[model samples]
Target: MGGSFGANLRRIRDESGLSLAQLAAKINYSKSYLSKIENDLKPPTADIAKRCDSLFGTAGFLSAMVTAGERPDGDQDEDVADDEVWVMVAGDDGERRFHRLPRREVLTGVGAAAGFALTGGARAVVDEPTLAGLRTMFGQYRLLGTTSSPATVLAPVIAHVDTLRALAAAGHPESVRRQLLLLASRAAEYAGWMSQEAGDERAALWWTHRSVAFAEAGGDEHFASYALIRRAEIAMYRQDPLTTIELATLAQADRAAGARILGLAARCEAQGHALVGDRAAYRRALDRAAALLAEADPAVPVLGSSSVSDEVALADGWSLYDLGRPAEAAAALDRQFPGITASARRARARFGARRVLAHAGNGEIDHACELAPAVLADAAQVDSATVRVDLRELARVLARWPGHPAARELRFALGTALRVRPGSGG
Candidate 1:
């Protein structure tokens, strides 16, 4: 139905040699707004259709919507359906992400979390079997963390990295030079993630720095760049736009880094620009990210793998949503979230919150609230400052909505999450 209406509008508008902005001018709306409507976002109302029809000398451009509205609300179905997800994650704002997962992801991620819990003192050796084990843990952890909120999920993440440090120090095992460094790299990332979820920016920074050092030492420039990305994330949260842009740019210059680096760098720059309200800068960064996305090669991604690829698209979508481009942001997220494996759950949970933000920006209150359950569940799973800060932001946004049945329930969850009452069953 959307295809038919969109085609009609596009055909009439384009054949008349009118750009989107030109048509928008005739209708007294913004070019982007009109484009969104044509793209099936804001279904044209009666008045809007009359104006468009009069201008195009055509009718029925909005017939699809008139017909569709007779049925049930589509936005209601757009709500995330992952019920029974754990709610242990903490958030600073409210962005939640849901990553795809393979069946083996949970076992691997849970094991790694357990291992790190037991061994926070040192590094680990990496034979094929050992690396494979950690890899599986990472894979599953990634998936759960992405889809579920961080509150329920962050404890295991903290434990996993701590244990990785201990595992790395196992009797100076053979071929251990790079292996130990890699272990540090992996541990650092997990530590950073946990700290970020727990609402401790200072801790998050510490872990990010440690992650960067290890990745560098291991000659994994790409992973090291990831640490740089997290550092920039801290800066963005602190409202230090200039600093974030600088750090993101520095990270971007590391050509040895993979596609993820380019995407993250662009995403950071976009976020900084958005914070400073620099529309031009934000658009340029977003465009650059979109262009760089084509360079992403298809790799054989399996379940329970912890390898870093591109997080740019998700980050970019977030930046766009933050920058008043909610409709485009939704398109970007829709494309980005489906491909990632479930092993990346923490990040995925954050992405889900982003989706909620997009819905809110688009005036879909019910859709946004309906998604609240999954996001809140992930919030319980997340325990990093990075994730927790996002939760805080989410709570603030939810607060603005004024009235809802779950308002009080969500408020309690947010309050409990924001405060660090250790041993209080947080």
Candidate 2:
């Protein structure tokens, strides 16, 4: 994989008529380092690949090459060994520590059942009131997630899932057990999203798989399809459009899936199409998603993002940018972005960053710069990794006009938001 990436990089660089030194200068890498990468003596990083892709106008080819090569071993499955356990401890300073450790170490002298107990007393009854309270708490947690850093929300969400699982295993009524498991699955799913926001893709996949396991244990087979959508989202972030499309298509294959799930899957499929520059397919998928969403029952439990009122519209605007219709993208995003609630800091940051990118891509440098400060503020508040993807691209776009004062200022502000050195291909 490394050899393939290196060869491709060299081929593209040569085809573009750039010397090693010239390419290195453009991408902020040392000439010697670029040479080593071209020779396959050193592996490429995702950052370097993105820089080269932006420089060479290869869409996401270089980034996809890096993603394909860098995927971790054992990332395709959601299996946990029986001999392993997740141990969490709460401290007096309101900090929680979590670790996955060998079961033998923690259960040395204690029986496995006793070791897994939440407390040293008779089991607490899993009742309606408790379940209702937990459900309400989960809703609150979801709201908190939108505004707080994922790091701030992840520990409690995981702890809640563990509690729900423990309650479900306490020989409760079948109905109660199923509800508990389903709720646990939901929390676990949210944990997966937060994990992604925290920039740990492997952990995000693990939690998503765990969500599917929980849902399956509760006899809710529909969640497995939704889990595919989640995986598709991760693939989208990796710039692997083919995998994104495949996973999203599989997600939509379950005819029995709810309208909301199908709609979300279609939205993801549209993103996949946009990534590959398939404008017609992207429009079809987006239209399908929008119709499904409109026909969906609002009383049904929400699956994906709850903040965005019109996800398909926002996605259409987002896809337009990827389809090289930046002026149209800017207009569409401008229409939809304001509908997002101010409290949805993460969502606002993500879409707002894209809107700024669209403006920049349309050569509205002053307008892009004018819009950036607020988006950067929201991005910093949320500490979002996804938002930084666009910000990095914005930095690249603004770099083309280093002499323009507003562009230079915006670039420096972007560097600050991303916590990288200015003009360093953030």
Candidate 3:
């Protein structure tokens, strides 16, 4: 369903023999974003669509999105299409535009990871054009998630980012380039998410590093601090918790950034604490994450793991769940989902898995089993490996009840999923 868009985008761009960073320099999109659109978890809007076709000379690259049947029919009535669009650091209004960006076959925790990599709501001095265009871009993409099909939903946002990178490379003044460097942090993070979501880890890490570089280039201490946290999460999952703890502490030292940044630093440190089984310290860090999160403005849009106030809430809840606080974890996880623009999609496979995890933590096995499928339609959705950490635990929880059909079913599914992850021999 992704329509060879990402592959085609990459082939075309790379055939030109340009490195992602080089291509990004030419146009203005972050190398990471262009990398994602080429991979497909995200689609492009007409603005971006046209830009790609123009740059790569691929006609109909964007045409399909505009002509697709996935557009939501209901929001045609929500007249506030008036939100501003942040373009290369300039803030302006979002347009009544249409695009034909390619799509992902599914959505999953990949976005969660990307969300983790982005700015954690603590504001930064951004590039102007990007600021103007981003306002509309963010608002539109949120709605797009609810409106489009798996084939077209995410790509547009990624595509927009790709286009911005393209624009950034067009050689605008240092002012514009500087702003894009800031936006590039967000774009690259999204690119990493989309690429990882599409199951391309090499691309994911590439975007991730590039994002950190962008943050650094822009003199963006805040963004750089945030990117480092994402690296910590990557290390945590790989089970290299020492590195996770180190990176998390590095971010913690940048407290001058703001509450959201400090909150993320605390969250990352807490994750490391849980890994080391330092119960007391983990609890202390968890308490700090909770406090910083509680006092912050929920709507300012902190990107990634710290984006929404409820984001830290969700992460804290999951961390606690991982640390074995079933009751408390269930309670914390419940504080999230402050309502994505339309809200019905969570009933899908990926979100369902997380839902199942929380339900299980609350001793609701029946409910827990239910979350396994709705959101995980594609094993590859949350990155080819088993990105849903809770599922890895599902096998254990269900094994305790070996005879139930539901438990048996969960066990079989989890076992198969385990083998797909690169080194998960167990």
Candidate 4:
């Protein structure tokens, strides 16, 4: 059994085209020690077997083969069915958060080309130029997402995340490795945001959880806190106000987080307060957010181009509407409407649809209907789930005035825009 295992290890190493010394270096083993194991003079430990499995993308095939040979044949496939792998990362409260991934998904070594990309855990090098490229790509993707449907960038963002994950796992100089992980964190957060916008709540949460883990592992407490705030934003979108408040509060408690993150947390908390009609608490949160923003640096740390002021205003509008101050919400939204660039179709759809709802909420059905065309157009163009949500709410309000031609027209437009059947789902 030991000889067979050694033969299998040697075969895999040969197939990978790595010399014994190089392979040993990659796996952090001495060459002579690995040679002894390969020649069956020394048996491979469970740790070595698992590392081999990960490196080869064999889904534990080698591990099972080696370990099973030592046991009765009947017990050979006992552990074969364990397809899920759980990764535990430290949570903000010092507890562990478990992220479960299918063994197949994380191990790209299933294919020949992908297997070659696995550099083990040794000193894999990703140059500064490559890191800079990833950052620039992230910046472009994020900027594009602000104005366009996130669906357009989701796949690419996920692919970029895979690259970063591979690089981080393969190892690098300490500083470069940390930056790579932070890059992964930012990409994952963007992916989560896109998933949420596209209406895949489960995917959104999954990516958000991954983002938090990556951020923490990368030693960026501030980014980790910001990820929680983003999770709170998702909660807000789901109309889960209590969860939103909880997550936002957790983020706020991260004293290591910078002012921008703190301000974002306060804004999210304020949104939750508004949702529950706690006007005083909402007011207090808004005031605190204002102060925090005043002290915040002009540029966002990760993505320097995002306008914090615009984000705050958008949050304010949403919260105001939730608080039943539709007039003020509509007014606030109007001020930022023109400033949102042409490419930010998703942003335009959300704010525009919200403004329509605000007008409808304030007994201005005619004006709300007047703004319906542009909102509907953007909704149809982007196919955004977030916009569809706001549009659905607006439809419910407009439904109250059946006699109004504008209301009927608006409802008809929304139905066409969102593909919502007359008696079916929202």
Q: Return the top candidate by TM-score.
A: 2
TM-score of each: 0.56, 0.77, 0.56, 0.70
Score each candidate by Cα lDDT. 0.59, 0.81, 0.55, 0.71
Tens digits of per-residue lDDT, candidate 4, 322-376, equal: 7656778889888878887766676778788998888887678889888889877
Candidate 2: worst-modelled 10 consecutive residues by lDDT: 106-115
Question: Residue-wise lDDT of candidate 2 within 1-426, one digit each (tens)?
Answer: 345788999999999999999987665457997889989899886556756765687776776776564544534545557556444444575443445667566454233234355366577776888889999989999999898777678767876777787678879899999999999999989988987887767667778888998999998989999999999998888766778899999999998898999989999999987776666677899999998889889998899999998898899999877765677889999999999999999899999999999888777889998999999888877877777888998898788677889999999888887884212234
lDDT of 1 by residue, 1-426 (tens): 335555667777889999988876555456876677778776654334534554564433353234343433321112212221121333454533333233134323444334544668334446788677776876566666554544555556645654554455455554564665676567557655655555555556655666666667666666756667777776776646667788888878877676646765777788877654455777788678667655655582321124325565666777665544566666787688767555555555667777776665555557766776776565455444555555666566566555665655666666876674333443
TM-score for candidate 1, residues paired by index? 0.56
Highest lDDT against the true fold, candidate: 2
Q: Residue 286 lDDT in model 1? A: 69
State the local distance difference test value for candidate 1: 0.59
Query: On lDDT, who's better, 1 or 4?
Result: 4
